[model samples]
Target: MPRETDDHDDPTRRTYLRYGAALAGAGLFAGCAGEADPVPEQTETPRTDEPGTTTETTSSGQAREACLFPVGCREFTDPPDSVTTYNMGWADMVVALGHADRLRTNRLTAPTLFYDRFDIDYEAGYPALWQDGGFSKEVFYELDSDLFLLDPNLLEAWDDNWDESDTAEIESTVAPFFGCYNRRIRGEWQLDLGYPEQAPTMLESFDAVGTVFDERARTDAWLELHADLQARIDDRLPADPDPPSIALINGGSAPGDGEFYVLSLADDGYEMKPYRDLGLVDADGFAGIETGQYGLTDYETMLEVDPDLILVHWGITTGSVTFGGDGAFDATQFREQFVDPMASHDVGSQLTAVAEDRVLPGPTAEQGPLVNAFQTELTARLFYPDEFGVLDLDAPLDVPESEQLFDRERVRDILAGDL
Candidate 1:
C-alpha cells in the first residue's frame, strides 16, 4: 500500500569499441514489442569514456553524463526536451523526475489505470503516444526525438530485430539509447540475445538516468527518501520469523492454461528487490531447478518443489491484460484464476502454500522507484504483520507523517520544481 500521490508512486550499454563498423550497414528493420511499451523519439549523441568513471559533465557545464552496464559513457548536452520510453519502468522514471510532459510516446495501452493510481496527467495540450503494437525506425525518424529511453536488446525481440548496426544508426542519426530490458532474468531467450548477465540495481539505473536528464539533485532527494525506507524496513524485520520459501511465477489470464513463467530469483535484478530486501527464500533456485532464461514448466514439475508460498507477478508488460477493463485490479479474478486453480489442482494442492492460502499477488514486474517502494512496503506488511502493520490491499496506506517511509511532499515539490 502507498500514499495517494499528488503525482504518482513514481517514480544500460557497453562494448562501444566497434562503433564505426556497426553504423556502416545500419538499415530499417520491422519493429517488435519486446518491452512493456514503446517510446516516442528524440535526437542527440554521445562520446566514449573509460570504464569505471561515473559522471562526465560537459565543458560548458550545462550538461551531465553517466554510465551503467552495456552503454559505456554518454553525455547529455542539456536535459532532453522530448523522450520516448520502451517500457513503463522508464516512463515511470521520467515521471518521477517531473518530466512526464517530455514523453514523446510510450507503451501504456491502459494509461487510465496508471495515471489514476499515481495521480499524474500529462500537461494539457501534450498528446500521448501509445504503442499498442511494435514501433518502427520510420516512426523514430519521423518523431525526430531528443532521446530514446529504451533497451537495445529488446529491439532484437522485434519482428525485424535490430542488430548492433541498427542501434548505431539510431545513436548516430537519432537520439542515444539508454536502459536495459533484460534486467529480470526470465528465461533463456535473453541468453541467445546476449542480454547483460548482470543488471544494475534499481537505484543505480535511477542515478544514471537522473544524471542524463540533469536531475541529479532531484534524484538525490529521492535516494534519500529510499534510504529512509530501507532503514524503516530494517527496523521491522520480525525477530525469528519463518522466512517462507516462495515461487515467483508469471501466468496468463486463463485458468486451465498450463502456463507457468517463473523468474530466476537468484539472478540480480530490480525485479527481485522485494524478495531479497524482505528476506524470502527462492524455492526454485534452492531446489536446483534448471530454469532457462525465459523457459516454461508444467504444473507437475512446479509441484516437485512445493514452495511454502506462491507470489504471482502481474501487470508487467503491455501485452498483459487487466481483467474487467479500465481502472480494474481484480483481486477476485486473480484468486479465482491464478491462486485457486493452482491450489485446487491435485498436483498443486499438496504444496504448503496452497494449503494455507499463502499464494499472493505481487506488484507489477515493471516497477520503478515509487512502485518498488510500495511493493516493498506491501511485502513487509504481508510477511510480518506483527512487526509491520497490516496493509489493506484495496486502500491507500495510512502511515503517519512521522512514520512515512518516503517524503511525498518532497517528491511533489521536486516534481513541481518548487525545491
Candidate 2:
C-alpha cells in the first residue's frame, strides 16, 4: 500500500529541511532506533528455521557476541536465514568483525567498494561501497542475499510514499531493519549533526553487529581500542590558552562561488551525547547553521566570523549528477582543478585554516573503518594539534605531493593548492 503523505515518517521536505532546531543528543537526527533496522522494501524468500548456534565467551569476560559489535550488543540466538542486509553501515561493521565474507546481500552501498577494498583503497572503500554513489540494482539483486539491515529513508529511491508505506505485506522474507535515529527523516544525512565522529559510531555499530554475530570478545576489544583512541584524543587536547574556534567548509559547484557549504554542531555546542562517543562537538561552545542545505556566500561572511581555524570537507550532492546519477568524491572533477582556487577565495584565504593550511576532505578510499572514524578527529586535530595530534589526510587520497602534508610540524608547507 502507498503511504499517506501526512504520516509521521513522511514529514514534508520543505518543513523537514528546516530541521526543527535539534536539541543536544548522541546523534543529530535520531538515527532510527537501531542501525540494523531497514524500511521494508522488497523482501527475500523465506527459508525454514534451522538450528542456531550459541556464542561462547572468551576468558577475559568477553563473549563472542559482544566482541564483534560493541554498541548494541545482544546474543542473536537465531541467525536470520540469508541476511537481507539493507544499509552500508552494517556491511562495514560486519567486515571489521572478520565476518563480512558471510554477508548474504546488502542493499545500501555497492559491490564495487568490496572489490576496491579487497584490492586497493581501504579507507574510502567501505562507506564508498555502501553509500557508494554508483549502486546498480542489477548487481545488487545478482548477489541474492536474505536478511536486510536497511536505512528506511533509502525507500525514496523506489517509492515516493515510502516513508509512510509498509512492504511487509508482500511476503518477502526479511529481518527487522536498523537505522541511525536521524536517518529516518528525509535529507537528514546531509547535516553534520556534529554527532560523535565516525569511530565510536562504528564501535556502536560494532556493538550492534556483535549482537547479530555473537562476537562479544571482538566487540569488547574494538570497544577498548575505541576508548583508548578517545582517551588519547582527550588527553591530548591543546592546553594552550585561547582554544581556537573551528569551522567546516565544503567545496561546491553550485553558483560557482568560492566558499564551501558550511556545517554546524548540533544544538550549538560540541559536547553532545554522540560527541561523547567521539569526544567532539560540544553543544555549549558554538552555534551551528540552520538552513542545512548548500548555499552560496562571498568571502566577507567568512571573515566576519574570524574563524580561529578553517577546515575543508567538500562534497556537492546538489549538482545535476546526484539522485540515481553518478556522483561521489571520485567522480567529481573538482579535486584536481577546482580544489585550490575554491579555497583561496576571500573567506577561504583570510582564515588561519587556509593560511596555516588546516583543510581536509572527509573520504578515505580503502580504510572503511577509518572513514567512519574520520569526521570528529579530522576536524578536531586540525584546530587543536597539540591536543588532537598531527593529522595526515592527503596521503590516503594519493594527492600529488601528499608527503608534504604528512610532515609532523608543518603539513600545509608541502601540500599543493591549485584553485
Candidate 3:
C-alpha cells in the first residue's frame, strides 16, 4: 500500500532530547584512512545475468561462496576499492544474487535513526556491530565503500554538513558515495512529490539504482520477488475481498480515523496500481489532498466518508505534530502530545478499520535494494493475503542466514535514531 503524505514535516522534526554527550556514549565516529585500492578504474556496469563461474578472494585469504556483504576481512575490485554498507536493504539485495564478495561490513547495532527509509526492525536476527546513535557511521567505518548509495534527502543533509576533510577522509579511507533518489524531494522541482500515483515508486527506484550499480539483474530478481509475492497474495485474498476504503493521516492521527492515504502492500507507503491490480474497488467520492511532504488532509471530510481502513504515517520529525522536547527527534513526545490526541476520537477508534485496528506505520524514505523488496513483499502480502500465505507483517523483511544483514533487531535499533 502507498503511504499517506505527512501531516506535517515529521522527518525534519526534533524528537528525543539531544543530550549533550562527549562522544563516549554513542561512540562518535572517527574517520578511517584510505587503504590499497581493490578495483582499478571504477565505472558503472550492468551485473552479469548469464551465470558464470568465478572465485573471489577476501583480504583474509579465506574465500567461501561470496553472496552479499560478507563480514570480516574482505576486498573488492570495484570502483570504491573496498567498501561495506550500513543499509540492510543494500546488503540483503547484494547477497541474494550471490555477489557477497562485492561488499563487506554490515549493521553494527547502536540505536534507531530519526526516520527509517528502509525497515531496520527485521535485521536483528544476526549480529552486527553498529546500530543507532550515529546516522551512517557503521556503514561508513565498517566497510571500505568507495561509493555510498544513499537517499537524496540524506545526501543533501550530508552535502550541507560535509567538508573537504570529511570527503578526503572518506575517499582516502573508503570511497566516494553515490546519492540515490528517495522520491521525496522539494515541490518546486522533483518527481513523485510523495504521491501514490506519481513517478519514482519502488519499482522505478530499483531500476534507477540498479542501473548505477550494474546490478540490474539482481534488481530485476528482487523486483520479480514482488511479482511472485503479489501474485500469491492475490490468489489467497478473497475473490470478492472488500476494498479497504482508506484515508491516511498525514503525519498525525486521522481526523475521524477514516483516512487511508492509499493501500499499503510493502510498508514504503501506498500505491494505487497495486490495489487496482488486486481488483479492489474504492468509493469515487473520496478526496485526495496534496500538500508537498505534509499530506494536509480534510479530516472532517474523511469522517463523513468513513473509510474502512486508516493508515497513519507516524515516525519522528513531523513539524506540525511536534512535541516540545530538547532532542534531535522524539517520537514519544509527538505521539503523546499530537498523535495520541487523534487516537481519542470516537469515530477514529470506531471506524471499520479502527474496530479491526488496520493501522500500518512505515518509514518515510530510504530505498535500499533488500529493503525495497521487503516492503514490496510485506505490502503485497497485506493487500493479497490468501495467495501470499500470511507473510510476516513487518518492516525490512528478513534476508536468509547466508545473506547479509540477517540480524533484524540490530537494524531496528539503528533505525530508532533520527536522520
Candidate 4:
C-alpha cells in the first residue's frame, strides 16, 4: 500500500508560489530544451511481417536546441552531466545510452540485481539517491541533477497532488524533465486526470533522450540493431497465421484482495509494444474495456473473456513481489507466494489459462530497445514454440549464436563508444 500523505501543504504551497513567481518574472523556461515536433496520434496499424521494412525516424540533429511537445518547448545549450531517473524504463534508457555513469538517482531498490539482470558492471558501491520514495520536490532540489529523465505527466499520475505548477518549479530551479510517460494505453481516465498529451513510443522517447545527450549516432546504431532483430522475427512468422489471444495482467498490483490490474493492448503502450507489434490479438481489447487504463478486474471479469493466454508483467514495484503486497523477487518466492497461490485459488484455478498452464510471466515492465528485443524473442517462443525455440527459464538469457536476434557484443561496443 502507498504511504498516506497529505495532499495539501500550506507552507510548501506558499514557498513554491513565491519561488515560481520569481522564476517566471526572470523568464525561466518551463519545458524541455530540445527541438521536437508534435507527436502525431499513431492511427496506422503497426507494420506487418514484411522483410526490408523500417519505421520512420522523426528525431535528428546533434545540437540540442529545443524539444517540442503539446504543451511547449525548452531549449538546451549544454549537455547534462548528471541525470535523475525514475523507474526501470528511464534507468534502462540511461544504461543503454552509455550514460549510466551520469545517473545521480535511480528507482530500482536492488541496484545490484538490476545490474546483474542486464549484465552491466558499475562501481562496487555506486550510490543511489532514493527508491520508490514517491517523488519529493525537496529531494529534486537537494539532488539538483542536470536533467530529469522522467515525464511530468507520470509525476502527476503517481501523485495527483502535483500539477503543471509543480513541474514548472522543478524545471525553473533544478533541471528540465525530458521524457514522455510511455507506459499506459491511453484511456478516458487519463483525460479526467489531466494528462491529455499522448506519450511517445519507446523508440521515440529514446530518440529524444539521445538528442538531449548529443548521442544521435549511438541512437542510430541501436535503431539499426533493432531493425535487424525485427527483420529476423518477421522472416520466421508464418504467413497470415492466427496468433493466440492474450490477456496481459499485472497481478502484483491488485488494488484490493482477489483483483488484478488488467492491461489493455488497444492503445499500444510501451509495455505492450512488442506483443502488439507481433500482431498478437488482445482478448481484453476484444471484450471492450475502453474507458479505463489499468482497470481493476475481478475473477468474474477475467472469466468472462477466458483468454487463451495470460501474461504476468514484472517490475510493477521495487522489492515487493506484488505491488502493495509484502514479498520479494525470488524464484521460490514467486512460485510459493504468487504462482502457487493463484494456481490454487478458486477463481484462478477455473480460468482456461490456469487449466492449460498457459499463465506465464511476461517481460519486465520497464523496457528499452534492447530489452524490447529480448521481449520480442521471448514472446515468439511463448506463442510459437514450434517456430521459435522454447525459452529456458533457469538458464542464463544469452541466446545461442545461431538463435541470437542481435549482436550483444556489438551493442556493448556501441554503448562503450568503441564502435
- For every candidate in turn, the CA RMSD to the true structure comes to 9.3, 12.4, 14.2, 7.4
Which 10-residue window in model 1 sums to the lowest lDDT?
1-10
Better candidate by TM-score, 2 or 3:
2
Tens digits of lDDT, candidate 2, 249-343 = 43332213543455443321111222333333422222443323343344565556656555333332211132243323343343443346535
lDDT of 4 at 358: 70
Local distance difference test, per candidate?
Answer: 0.57, 0.36, 0.37, 0.57
Between candidates 2 and 4, name the one with more favorable TM-score: 4
Error of 1 at 376 (Å): 1.5
Instruction: Pick the TM-score winner.
Output: 1
Clashes of each: 24, 82, 97, 9
- Residue pairs in clash, model 4: 32-74, 33-74, 33-75, 34-66, 34-67, 35-66, 35-67, 36-68, 252-323
Candidate 1 residue 4 Cα shift, in angstroms, is: 29
**How should the candidates be ordered by lDDT, best one leading?**
1, 4, 3, 2
TM-score of every model versus the real structure: 0.75, 0.54, 0.45, 0.75
User: How do the residues 247-275 of candidate 1 rate in per-residue lDDT, one tens digit apiece?
Assistant: 77754433356656665455545666776
Give the higher-TM-score candidate: 1 or 4. 1
